[model samples]
Target: MAEFSNSNTVIVAAGENLPLTETAVKAPACIVHREGSGLVTLRGLTSGQCRARFKVSFGGNIAIPTGGTVGPISVALAVGGEPLTSATAIVTPAAVENYFNVFVAAFIEVPRGCCVTVAVKNTSTQAVSIANSNLIVERVA
Candidate 1:
């Protein structure tokens, strides 16, 4: 039987459009997202099945209109700047001012030395606030 391993969890509090200008610092266990760009890059991963999970809590003060998009939050898993799987959640009129959590998971192929990143973006007219956000990656194989 093969032993399974999990990577360290990376977290970001503020949920904003990550800048595409800078790269995050490299780490052996886990990589943290950049200040402007909400992306975490991991290196030296094995090529196999890996599970990625993300959770985000967000809310706004303004009431969301019926059928109107208040806040749209998107999380994605990418390798070499290409997205493999992505999930998006939007705040509806019923979820205004309340903290909502968005969870996404997927099994993907992680290539060795390939930069793996978790990114978040918010596309809403109103100002959105994120209370907490986190990402976890585990090697199932």
Candidate 2:
């Protein structure tokens, strides 16, 4: 079995989409973290079934306009730029004591040297703050 994991506590701005990189998250030895990129290189593996998991903890502060709406925070898993799965949650106003969390899990066929990435996106008009996030990948064959 092969496995890799990373975590981030940095704040992600509103309306921003970022790929979680290995350098930024400091993944363990089984996974090679790319510098300045969201992709994590899976090493010592061949074509097989792999499972990926993404989790994001985020919140924001904004006064919704009379007829405006807040947003749905989203987290996604992708392999070589192709989206495998995604999870989304509604974010409530900061004053309302609402914090949003999203988790996504996907099973995909990963070829040797394939790149796996986890991404977070804030679709709200107001800036949303991310408290922390985590990603885990495991080879199950």
Candidate 3:
């Protein structure tokens, strides 16, 4: 099995997409992705290997806005614009500007030739900041 991975140390604003700009020095040909992109396309999958185990891992420091009373964050893996079932990760912050270490990881099964993405949703009523974040994707046979 070939594995392709990328990451970016950047902030994902509220209700905005994330682009993993840092491509790996060594990349696999089967997985195609553009630099500074948020989508990963799978290629060259046969019936025997139609299903791939997709692993998404990410972490960031976050801070809630002043007078915020809502919950933390929800992270998940989505394929073809639909979130996977039972693949969501949640993190809750207890204090203000506490440098919370929020890490979310999901392992999902995807068919061949599908586009995968990492999604972060804010559950709080106030705006939250996610900084110094990175996302990594891996394929498992």
Q: Each prediction's Cα lDDT score? A: 0.40, 0.44, 0.55
**Highest TM-score scorer:** 3
Residue-level lDDT of model 3, residues 48-106, one tens digit each, is 77676756666665665455554675544555555544554566767655456666667
Q: What's every prediction's RMSD, in angstroms? A: 9.0, 6.4, 4.0
| Per-prediction tally of clashes | 4, 0, 0
lDDT tens readout by residue for model 2, 1-141: 222223444444555554453333344444565443455555435435343332223222222332334544443454554444444444455342245555556554445554444434545555554444445555444
TM-score of each: 0.46, 0.50, 0.63
* Model 1 CA deviation exceeding 4 Å by range: 1-37, 47-86, 123-126
Candidate 3 scores a C-alpha RMSD against the true structure in Å of 4.0
Cα lDDT of candidate 2 equals 0.44
Residue range 1-141, candidate 1, lDDT tens digits:
111111222222223442333222233353444444545554434544343322222211222333434555333334444443444455453464445555545544435555455444444444444433444444444
Model 2 misplacement above 4 A: 1-9, 13-30, 35-37, 47-69, 85-97, 113-127
Alpha carbon lDDT of residue 34, candidate 1? 44
Error of 2 at 127 (Å): 4.9
